[model samples]
Target: MRQHEAVINVMEEHGGYATLGFLNQEVLKVKDCVWKTKTPFASIRRIVQDERFFFKIKPGLWALKSYKEKLPTDILPTKEISKSQKEEFNHTYYQGLLVEIGNLKKFQTFVPNQDKNRLYLGKKLSDITTISDIYKFSYDHIVRMTQTIDVTWFNERNMLASLFEIEHSTPMYNSLLKFIELQDFYTDFRIVADDARKKEFQSKLSLEAFKPIIKRVGFWSYNAVAELHSKTSELISIESKLRL
Candidate 1:
C-alpha cells in the first residue's frame, strides 16, 4: 500500500496521466522498496480500480485524477463507441491518410507536369441527382462526376496515377460503380477500410457485374494506411537530406 501510494504521489508530482509501463519503471527504481516481489502494475491497477484515480481511455492509455477529483462519467471503450461516432472517427482517420497521400504526390517530380491540381476528392453523388442531369453538364462537370473517385492522383495531362476509396462501414457498391465508370488502364485502384472488412470487400467485388475490374482493385486496411503515412514522412526526410 505504501509503495503504491508513493508511486501515485510521484505521478501526481509529475502532473498525472502516465502509462502503466512508466509507473512500473518508476516503482522498480525505488531503493529496497517493500512488496518488491509483487508486480507494481498489478498493484497500481488494483489501487486505481479501488480508489478510482483515473480512467482507462484505451488499452495502455489513461487519464488520471487528483485526490477528491470526480471521475468523468462519459468514458467508454472503443467497442462502445456510438454508430455515428465510429463513422465520424473512421472518416476523419481515412481523410487524414488521403491528405497525406495527396501531399506526398505533390513531391513527386518523376511524373511529367506534376502539380497540386493532380489530386482531387471525388464529388458525392448528392451533387447530381439524376443521370439525365449528366447530359446538360459541361465536359469538366461530366469528368468530375464520372471520375468521382474518393481520392485520386493524376498527372498534368489528367491521366490517373492512383485512386483510393475509404469504405468505412459504407456499401462498396457506389465506390465500385464510380471506379468502373472512370476505369483507366494502368491506374491503381485501392479500397481502404478496417482490417476486419477484407472478407466483406471480397464478397462485394466478387459479384458478376464487377468481375471485369475486380482483378485491378486492391484492399488496404486502416493499419496499412497508417504505416504508409509513417513511411511517407521518412521518404520526405530522406529526400530533404539528399537535396542538401
Candidate 2:
C-alpha cells in the first residue's frame, strides 16, 4: 500500500488514533514504502481529509473514528423477561460491564478472551475519537442493559435490586465461550473431545453447581463491570484510569 493507505490502515486498526511518530516508524520499516520517498505526515493528513480517516486530538496524534455507519437504534430485550426480568437485566447489564473491563484489560495487557462481547464493550473500546466519544459509547452500552432486561417488568421503585439478581456464571461462561469462538476454536471439537467429560461433569455436579455459580458469577461480574463504569465516567477518569 501507498503511504497514505498504510497510515489509514493503522488508524483503522487503532480506532483512528495512530501517532505520527508511530506511523513514521512503521511505514519506514516497510520495504515497499521507502521512508525517503514517501511523505508520511502529509499522507496522514490527506487520508484524514479524503477518506475521513481520522482527525487530530492533540497536535500530531490521530485516532480512528467510525461514526458513519451507526449502530442499530432498536434494542432487543430478552425473552420471557417479565417475572424474572430483574434477574435477566442484571445478567445482561453485568455481562456488558465485565466486557468493558475485559476490553480495557486487553488494551493494557494480553487477555485470553479478548474477542467476546462481555457487555457490548467492543463498540465502546474500538476506534475511540474524542472524550465525548468515550462517554457516549459507555452511556449507550449501559442504557442498552435496561432495554434488554426491561427494568419496568420487575421493580417499580428499586431499580438496583432488580439489576442485582442476575446470575453471572452463565454470562461469564458465555463470554469465555465467545472468546474461544473468536479464536477459531470449533464447537464440534467440544462435542467430540469434551462431550463425555461435560456429561460426567454435569452428572457429578450438585444443585449449587447451577444456582451458586450463577449467583456468585452475577455478584462478582457486576462488581467488575460496575467498577469499570465508575472508573471511566469522566474524561479525566478515562485519561487517568482507562488510559484512553
Candidate 3:
C-alpha cells in the first residue's frame, strides 16, 4: 500500500488515535516501499493537511472524517463550514466531541469502582429501609454514588425513600448529609434531591465539594479502562475511605 494508506490503516487499527512516533515505527516494514515510502513520516502530516482527512483527537492522535464521534450533538453539516472553515471546523468539532465523550465516559466508567465497594458493603439501598438503614445507606451511597454511572437518574422520591428506609432504624445526620453531597445541578433528579432537603443542608455545601468526589470516582473507573487519561482528566485522590 501507499505511505498514506499505511498510516491510515494504523489510525484505523488504534481507534482513531495514535502518536506520530508510533505511526512512524509501523511504516518502516514495507518490502517494496522504503521505510520512508510505505510509512513516510511526512505523508501522515500531508494527509492531515488535506480537507477530507481531519484530526479527530490529539496528544492522542487522528482519524478519518467517517469515524463516529460520541459527542452530545451530531456533527454540523459540512456546508455549515465555509470552504476555508471546513478544516477549522473539522478540528473544532473533533475536539468538542473528544471532550464531551471523555466527560461522559469518565462518568460511565466511575460506577464499576463503586460497584466493587458497594458489593463489599453488602447493603445497597435496594436492600435497605429505615433511619438506621439510611445511615448505612448514606455511607455506602456516598462512596458508591460518587462512582455512579448515572447521577441524573436519582430523584428526591428515591432519595427520600432511601432516607426513610434509613430513618426507620438510625438517625445518622452524616449519611443524609452525604446523600445531599453526591448531587449535581446539571441533572434533574439531582436538582430534586438538592431541593427536597431544608435550606440549611441545601445551602451549606458548595457545588465544588461534590465534584471532586464524583471526579475521583470517575478517575478510578477510568484507571480501570486503559492507559488513557481518566474522566476527570486528573488522577484519583485516595483521601476518602469507603466505610460500610
Estimate every model's Cα lDDT from 0 to 1: 0.55, 0.34, 0.34
lDDT of 3 at 42: 54
Best-to-worst TM-score order: 1, 3, 2
Model 1 stretches astray by more than 4 angstroms:
1-82, 107-142, 146-148
Highest lDDT: which candidate?
A: 1
Q: Which predicted model would earn the best TM-score?
A: 1
Alpha-carbon runs more than 4 Å astray in model 3? 11-46, 52-61, 65-139, 149-244
| Model 1 lowest lDDT segment of ten | 107-116
For model 2, how does the per-residue alpha-carbon lDDT over 1-244 read when each residue is reduced to its tens digit? 6766666666565444544434544444455554353344455445655535555433234455563233221112334345454343334443443333333333211111222222222343122211111111124544343333211111122122112223322333333232222222111111101122343333322244344232222223333334344343322333543455
Better of 1 and 3 by lDDT: 1
Listed in order, each prediction's TM-score against the native is 0.53, 0.24, 0.27
Compared with the true structure, model 3 gives a TM-score of 0.27
Candidate 3: C-alpha lDDT: 0.34
